[model samples]
Target: MEKYIDIIKNSYSGYWNYLKNEIFFQNHWDNYFYGLIIISLLVWGLEILFPWRKNQSIFRKDFWLDTFYMFFNFFLLNLIILIALSNTAAEFLNDILSSVGLSLQSLQIFDVDNLPNWLGLFVFFIVSDFVQWNTHRLLHRVPFLWNFHKVHHSVKEMGFAAHLRYHWMEPVVYKSLLYLPIAIIGNYDAKDVAIVYFFTITIGHLNHANLGWDYGLFKYIVNNPKMHIWHHAKALPKHVRFGVNYGLTLSIWDYIFKTNYIPHNGKDIELGFSGDETFPKDFIKQELYPILSKNKDFD
Candidate 1:
């Protein structure tokens, strides 16, 4: 709360400085935000050229709403991440690290710094994305939590923008969980962050993609659109206990959890929760839907 006030004060008090440093390239996430745009363009292009649901148009239903999500999440919600997570994580993790008589600087016994750049990058991506996968599963499984997560699943027409589609509160829930552990590991650096974003953001678009370019064996390693589309299935298939295929980048987590589902005709799967034809279409209305729900139960 104080942090939000501080950001507002900073922006209003020093408008130009805030616009230049806080809101643009100088900010920590600016590069990644721009990268998201480029990646969206690429995925949008691919979906147009070699689409899975070929009859679907580029400006499909809810297209602008999803695009609004893409930009809103990329800019404002992400800025919240930088402001809210950074200082909070630094303070929280420092206390815990001090209790254990270890520090991010002194965790060098792990030699994370000296590792080959590529390996360090891999470690960062794997650990961070695993955190995301776990959080995603919780959003579906936990009834109370699903209120905030339902905006993401309400999508019936999946595409590149669908990747960025999520409740605005998601970063707070997911990134805060992400921040503490990474701060403890203390292995994160600019290079590692960049590498992780490069793969995760780009592939994230593909996972929500309307394309049929599923890599055969590689689908088992990295999640693809085919299996992921089922995650949005209107109803669970028989024998499926809960929402399945809860992977952010790698499919191995679902395999390990025994939750991976890939039906033979998964590509043709219609999405969104069953009996949910009343989900709102406008962005503001959808944002407020969860708040106004009379029967918000997930289970």
Candidate 2:
């Protein structure tokens, strides 16, 4: 009981500290808040300079809503709820393992510490992205998870901020699945791989931006706006039911698994699901709609 209380207290305090540092731009180089803003601005600038759809407004439809979602999903929900809950869950799992005379190190498949720093970071990046790729597929295939994922597909107008405009439940789903595979790689500071995080963030923003970049020869390796727009297409191919282009950072996974589908340029593809017209436009309603509503024809 005392241990649980301590965990809760530590979680809150840690979150508070993180929040202060983020807002104040303390250690600005390592701050995700700054990173998000910089990446969004950089991508938005690209959209302004070279928009694929010239008719689309700079202040696009639901721009502010998506902007709010960016901060909400990235900071508010993550710091206030997800981080605390995750820390507590980790502690609880550790306790259970200890009771059985085991530890996380015992379960580790490889000690990354033995490898060179660059090699370890590379392994971590590959494993993490692959895990996320699989998880993204599950979000499309599973009805319950798809309900939550709809909040992301709800985007009609793609923008840089739209990249982060996902349901808060998504991080919970993502982090829950990410925990074990990361743990299996053994002890390594996430800070060491901060470059990977920022790189992925930049790619994600570009993937959802108004730009129509396919990375030319590297389109098959890295996900791009041209490829990802099809992922949110209103009409799926006749054979493909769940979803297509399930890559988060790397498109190689989709190519390797035969899930890659880019019929056309997809520069002006109609976005959103079939019933998205009826899907709640309000953020609160969208969050609750998945849990409270009975309509389950999500495809």
Candidate 3:
């Protein structure tokens, strides 16, 4: 057992050493945050051409409210990650990845080595998305955890900001749970992890977008605006559509779970919760009151 532990420790050391020395990763710290910029462009661009919700305006009061939620959660999650997982915990993750034939060192978006950037990007997005879909399903089903998740479901509209409009606790808890199995199974490095998150935020906006543009071949593999917009439907019988399109990069998991919802057949889906009077309006109140209120109706 001691020998096994030592082997793990050595692997961790090597992976951490690789990260500390990698020039491309060290040089591109800004790319992690740059994801938000690309996503903003995608939404703005789509809204200009083929908006799904014809009456929906992108710059209204609801948009700003949802934007605030996204920024708040993004900042909170980054702060927690830096303070809680940056040093020793990250090294431990590196060790675990190495054991699984994945190295935190190998997943960097750019490399001094000869690895293909495109393949790495593809793998990172696909795996991380599966992790997200499963985690999201668990959040909805698990009674105790659903309290935090309700913050997301409370939103009454579909927009770019609605994508990030999530309870702060949900990201922390769900992400932690989802990554454990992946860490044990895959070789995601810090840089690859960052790119995955970058794509996630971008794709997240695409999924929540109120626009109606179809990107052809990519739409099959990626969650386009229409498919995800349906997921936010406020109508009953259809509200359960929330369980589908969990992927930020691919629709494969949704298909496997039988949770995939395609909006092509019909299009009467409305966005937001059905019982508006029952759902909280203010963001702060929503978070606090859900803990106090018993959602017997959810039964």
Candidate 4:
């Protein structure tokens, strides 16, 4: 009787230990995918409920192009980061940026070191979103960067997949520059960085989605598909319509900088520069040889 009671107590303790650490702590990726599935489904449902444009379906060519880059990043680029630059680079970056006021070090009032990891992550997300919003704007305004960025705007339509059809060089350059600031100031580890990566991906898909649902409260914090569609507007002249909606997560920067564009008509605006004489059809040409022909020669 006494022996049986002891066994029961021991079993309960073991179960509780597993529940606390293994079940709760170890479910990071599982929870990640689960949340992603839910968000993806919500976006899909919104697409069906209030699609801004139904005529523009996924482009077969663009679909494959996006898939190729997605797989390449998942299989190859990540492997390189994990192997080569994941460790020392993050530390070196953090140290250099620590001296400047660019980074928020330790959650302390002056240099608060007591902030929990969760709070730190939340702060990093906001800061990085601001950085990306402004950096993207800079690209649009700057002439040389526009050459690379125009490849993204070259698309004439919007969809979940359209968000992925970016110039490959833009990612390499933009991400490296963005990460450099975060790595220096944010004290982010590989795991935090991974969170930012997927967060950006999920946010980006939502950005290009045709969903019409609007969360009045969230509009200030996050940019919706409606706002983003205008960013891809092709006919609105250079630096006017497409220049706004630069926020990936927050709309504060866009609002503050006068880059926010609110659509007046309930219609899918004509996108892509039709004036070009010869548009590249294949991914290889757009991604690889954007400069082969002179810009003026195109149209």
Q: In order, what lDDT does every prediction score? A: 0.76, 0.89, 0.63, 0.60
**Which stretch of 10 consecutive residues in model 2 shows the poorest summed lDDT?**
290-299
- Measured against the true structure, the TM-scores of the candidates, in listed sequence, are 0.85, 0.96, 0.72, 0.69
Comparing 1 and 4 on lDDT, the stronger one: 1
Give the per-residue lDDT digits (tens) of candidate 2, residues 196-244: 8899999999999999889998999999999999999989876887889
TM-score of predicted model 2? 0.96
Give per-residue CA lDDT, model 4, range 194-216, as digits (tens).
Answer: 67667776777778776664457
Tell me which residue pairs clash in candidate 3.
Answer: 52-211, 102-187, 104-189, 234-270
lDDT of 3 at 63: 78
Which candidate would rank higher by TM-score, 3 or 4?
Answer: 3
Task: List clash counts for every candidate, in order.
Answer: 0, 0, 4, 8
lDDT for model 1, on a 0 to 1 scale?
0.76
* Per-residue alpha-carbon lDDT of candidate 3 for residues 3-92, written as tens digits (9 for 90 to 100): 545655665565445434442344455353345656777776776577666776667446777877876666544443432443345666
Per-residue alpha-carbon lDDT of candidate 1 for residues 199-241, written as tens digits (9 for 90 to 100) = 8888889998888766898988898888889888987865774
Query: Any runs in candidate 1 off by more than 4 Å, and if so which?
Result: 1-30, 80-82, 92-111, 238-241
lDDT of 1 at 4: 53
Best by lDDT: 2
Q: Model 2, which residues run further than 4 Å from truth?
A: none
